[model samples]
Target: MALTPFLVLGFCWLPYYKTSLVFKLCHSVSEAQQRKMGHSNVWNSHPKNYGPGSRTCRVCGNPHGLIRKYGIMCCRQCFRSNAKEIGFIKYR
Candidate 1:
């Protein structure tokens, strides 16, 4: 009967659909975890009590001239590297 072909098609597609859904869910979960870890790493990497206009890089601890960018005191080099964390993009 016609129902037999329809049933076979559904059965063949079911597993592939279920597997794709599971993979997407797992990928999202892992991405969330990675974002959490990246935030923690950024927080721990910066220095403490270091305000703007300080002559030191909060990230690399380089005792040199620093500029205030995105409310954090860091040298030009460090600032360029950490621009993404401060919601800015690094252009080459």
Candidate 2:
């Protein structure tokens, strides 16, 4: 009977590990909306870019558009367009 409580305690550790693996901000249904709007970061090879190619720019699909090199993610262009409306800064 005492062993049952210890087994329950061990089971608590598994859920903590699962939440750590969730990295992507959008997925499934949100991903579909992003695709329909022509804003996805899928990498393609067109004989340029040299090493491995680049992701489809989420801003304008330019392939070489402004994107962070670390994660290849891009925010909506509307962010820059409505910067002051949203109280954001660039030089700060």
Candidate 3:
């Protein structure tokens, strides 16, 4: 069968399609009802591109205490737990 742009290679919905569906649903509601739903619940929920909000730990998704040195994007807790495996030699 031929594949369309919307059709994912795997059985999963892409983020773009998911957010588009949400916007469509929100648009279907009345203006008053849409206003009551709040900005966060409807629009203005786009991903952060800059600033602290853009960076998050790869393992735990924590926004704070991230060790970004040497391209390590994990929080301190995750780093401590998997330090050895990550090639970090700790000296006692």
| Best by the TM-score measure | 3
Q: Write the per-residue lDDT of candidate 1 for residues 27-57, one digit (tens) a residue.
A: 2224455467569868756555555423567
Query: Model 3, 26-51: lDDT tens per residue?
Result: 22334454356566475757887988
Candidate ranking under TM-score, highest first, comes to 3, 1, 2
Relative to the unseen true structure, what is the Cα RMSD of model 2?
18.6
> Which of candidates 1 and 3 reaches a greater lDDT?
3
**Which stretches in model 1 have alpha-carbon errors above 4 Å?**
1-54, 90-92
lDDT of 2 by residue, 4-91 (tens): 1111122242232344354242122334453554443454323464432544545566544444545544545634675577566889
**Sort by lDDT, best first: what order?**
3, 1, 2
TM-score of each: 0.33, 0.24, 0.54
Q: Which residue runs of candidate 2 sit more than 4 Å off their true CA positions?
A: 1-52, 69-72, 75-79, 82-87
Worst 10 residues of 3 by lDDT: 1-10
Error of 1 at 91 (Å): 7.7
Pairs clashing within candidate 3:
none
